[model samples]
Target: MPSSTPLHTPFCDLLGCRYPILQAGMGGVARAELVVAVAGAGGFGCLGMVRESPDLIRQQVDQVRALTSNPFAVNLIPSATDPDLFRAELDECVRLRIPVLMFFWDVVADAVARAKDAGCLVIHQVGSVEHAKRAEAAGADMIIAQGVEAGGHVHGMVSSLVLLPQVVDAVSIPVVGSGGFASGRSLVAALALGAHGIHCGTAFLATKESFAHDVHKQKILSATECDTIHTDAFAINWPPHSNVRVLKTEVTESIESQPYGHLPDKIPRRVVAEEQGRPIYWMSTDSPLKSMTGDLEKLAMYAGQVTGQITQIEDVQTVIHRIVAEAEATLQQLSNRS
Candidate 1:
C-alpha cells in the first residue's frame, strides 16, 4: 500500500520515491542490501560504485533489481576511477537499465551525455554554487549541494546552512542539500532553504542494514557533534591533500599533532586472523564494512556533525518513516500557526 503521508515534495515525485530522502553513496559502505532496503522503504538508495569492478557493479545492480522495482541510484567518483573502468561501469549501468546515475569529485561530460542518451537521470554532486551552475549547463537532471559538514571526502568549505541556498539560487535544476542532516527538522529546513530534498550519509551509517561494522555503528550512536574532526590526514590512502571528516580516533589525534605535509610516509596496516586462521591485512583508511574484520576501532570512522542526532540503530524503513512522519507533523503545526 502506498503511504498516505502528507510529506510530498517535487524531488520525491522526480525520483519516484515516497519521500525526498537520498542515501549518500558512501564508498565501500553503500552496498546492494542497503540500497534495496532504502529504496524499498520509499527513499532513494544509491550504490557506491567507486573502485568497484564492472562485474561487481553488474551483480549489485542485479541484486537490487531482484529485490525492488523502485528507482535507485549509482554513484561514481570520476576522479578516483580509472577512465576505462568508469566507461565499463557506465556501460553496464546503461545496459542494466538503471534509472539514476550520479557523479562526484569531477564532472564527466561524456558520461553525462551517454547516461542521458540511455534515458537515465543524471545527478551531479557539487560543493559550490559555481559547480552547481556547471552541472546544470552540463545537462544534469539534478544537483546535490554538499557542504563541508559532510562526512568522508568533503570537497567544499562552506556549511550546508550556507551553501544550500546559494546552490539553489545558482542552478535551474533541482538541488538537494547534503551534510549534517539526520532528522525530520533538518529535512524540513532543507525545503525551507529551497532544496527539493535532503541527502544524508552519517545518519544512514547508523542504520541496521548498513554494511558498516557493528563497532563503527556503535561509535556513531555514541558520538557527539564534537566527536568528528575534518582534516587531510587520511588523504594518503586515496587523493593526496584532500579533506575528510572522521571520528576522533587515536590515529586522527596523532595526525593532528603533526605539522602539515609531515605525516607518516607509510599507510598503517592491521593484521587479523580469519576463521580459518588466515591472516588478513587491513588498511586504516578503509571503511569498516561487514566484510572486513580487523582493528576497526583504529580505522577511519567517517561521520558527520549530525552524529549527535543518531542515538540508535534502526532499520531503513523505520528511519525513513519516522523522518517523514515527523516532518509532516511539523509542517502541519507550522501551517496551523500561520
Candidate 2:
C-alpha cells in the first residue's frame, strides 16, 4: 500500500536530496555498484567500512566516485579497524571532503571531531536510547537506531518499530529508523514515529546491483518474516566479534544448537573451504565471504526479519523509486484519514 500523504522532511533537505530513504551501509554485502545505484536513484548510498583496509577503502572510494558524483557516506567500524588504518582512511575522507561519515561499533569523540572538522556530516548507528544519547553527546549530526530486525551485525536487540519512536522521543537530534524496513509502508511508519528518514538493507540486498550472490538472492526472495535468526556463530570464529542476522538454514541451525564459544567444533574446521577452489570462509578474515560465494544453503545468508516479504529480485532503480512513491502515497492516505 502506498502512503496517501505527501512525505517531506528536513533530513532530506540538507543534502538537497529528493527522498528521505537511505540505502543502509551493509557490511560485507555493500559494494560500489549498489551504493552508486541507490545514490543515483535519489537516496543516500553508504559504503560499509568494516574489515576494509586503507587501500581497499581508497579503491572503493575511487570506484564510487567514478560511478556518480552524488553524495555518499562511508560506514566505519571504529573498534575493529586499526587506529592507523582508520586514521589513514579518515584522512582520505577529509581529503575527498566526503559528504557523510556513518560510524558504528563505538563512537569515539576524537574521531567524531576529526570528521566534523573535515566538514562531513556524521551519523552514528545505535541500537538503544543510551547509545543514541552517547552518539549525540559525541557530536553525531544524526543517529541511526538499528533494531534487531536489521541484517548483518547489530548492536541492539530491540525491534525497529519499538526502538525508533523511543529513541526519537528521547533525543533532540534527527533519528533515522532502521531494521526490517523493505518498503514504503515501513518508510511511512518510520516518519509517523518521528524519524527523519528510513534506512533500508534487506530490500536493497535483493536488488540487481547488489553484491549478494544469485543463490542468496533467491533465499531472500523465498524467505519469510519468521525465517530469520540472530546468531553469534560467525562472530565466534571471526575476529573483532560481531553478531549476524541470517536466514535459518542448515549451517545456521547447527551453529545455533551448539553452546556459545563452540562454533569451530560444531562446524568442521575448514582451513580453506572454497566454492569451486575459490576460498570462501578463510580463517584469517572475519568478513562473510561465505555469502559472497555461491553457497547460500551451507553458508550464512544475512537478511532482515522482513525477508519473507520480499518475493523477487528487482532492479535497484525500480526498488528505490517504488519505495519513495509508495511512501508518499501512504502518507497522503494517512493524512486524509486524520
Candidate 3:
C-alpha cells in the first residue's frame, strides 16, 4: 500500500518529480517509451542516447514531449563513442532544449559549459569522490555516484554504501547514489547515507516498459545476488579495464576459459540477432536491444546484485509507488523506534 502522505525530499524538489527515484539512462535499453512512462508516473526518466543517432534522438525527444509535459533527461557517454558523432548528438540535444543532460565515464568541460549556456542542467556520474569534486568544479547541477555493484561498464571499485557518503561529503551539488539499488529499502538507506536520491538501472531494466528482451528481463527475475559476476571480458571491445556486472552465462564461461589477449577483436554482426538491415556494432559491450532477436543468450545480459530482489515484471507506476510507499513505512517505523 502506498503511504497516505507523499514522500518529499530535496531530490524530488530539484528534479520536480514526485519521487526521488531515477531510472538510469542505460545505453541500448532506455528508450522513449520507458522514459515517458517513468516521467508520467512522477519519477524522473532518462533516455540513454549514447548509442542513438542524432535523428533518432530528435524523434525520441519529440515522442517523449508528446507523451508527458514533465521534465526528463538524456544521458550520453561522451568518451565511449566517436567524437564527431557525439558532438552532433550534443548539438541536437541543445537544439531540442532538453531539460537535463547526464554525462558518464569522463567529463568534457567545454561541452558542459555549452549545455549550461543552452539552459540545460548538467548531471555527471562518477565513481570516486575526486571525480565528484571535479564534476562540481566543472559546473554540474548534480552528480551520480556509481559504485562497483552497478551493471554494465562500472566506473570504480567502491561499493555504493561506502561511495555515497564520500561523494556527499566531497561536493555541494546534490548527489545521487547508483549501483545495486532496486527497492524502497535501498532508497531509504541511500537517503540515510545523505544522498539526495537513488539511480536504479538493473531494476528498471526488468520493467514492462523497458526495451530489453523478454528473456533478459526474466534472467534478472530468476537471478540471485550470487549469480552476477564482475569482469572485464566484455570491455575488450570498449576501453580496457571497463568492468561490467552481468549474469553468469555460457558466453561468460567461454570468455573466462581463455586468456585476455586471446579474445576476439570484434564480435561479428551475424552473431547478433536483430531486425533485418539494422546496423549492429561489433562491440561485445552492447546490451541486448529490443530490436535484437538472435542468439540472445550470447549477448551481454547486464544486471546488478539487486536482481535477487526483483521477482516479477511490473509497470513503471507500480514500481515507483511501491518504492515510495515502502520507504514511507520504513521511515515511520524508524521514527517510532527512536
Q: RMSD for each model, in Å, please?
A: 2.7, 3.7, 2.7
Tens digit per residue, CA lDDT, model 1, 1-338 = 13545666778778888888999998878988899999888899999988688898999999888898888999987776777887888888898888999898767777788889999999999888888887788899999999998998888899999999999998888999999887888899999999989999988888888888898899888889999887776643465656778888766777676513523255554563232353434323466778766566766789999998889999998998888888888898899999
The digit string of per-residue lDDT tens for model 2 on 1-338 reads 11223565777775546678888887666788898898888888898766566676778889999988888898876666777877887887788777899998676889899999888899999889998998899889998999988987788879898999999998898899999787899888898899988888889888888876777788888889988877667653343345678787766656566513534334445543354454555222233333344333566677888888889899889998898788878877887999
Q: Rate the local accuracy (lDDT) of all candidates.
A: 0.83, 0.77, 0.84
Compose the digit string of candidate 3's lDDT tens values, residues 214-244: 9899899889988887877775346556677
Q: Considering summed lDDT, which 10 consecutive residues are worst modelled in model 2?
A: 282-291
Q: What is the lDDT, from 0 to 100, of the residue 108 in candidate 1?
A: 70
Runs in model 2 lying further than 4 Å from the true structure: 1-5, 236-241, 258-269, 272-279, 282-297
Question: How many clashes show up in model 1?
Answer: 0
lDDT of 1: 0.83
Output the lDDT of residue 113, model 1.
89
| Predicted structure with the largest TM-score when compared to the true one | 3
Residue 301 of candidate 2: its Cα lDDT? 75
Ranking by lDDT: 3, 1, 2
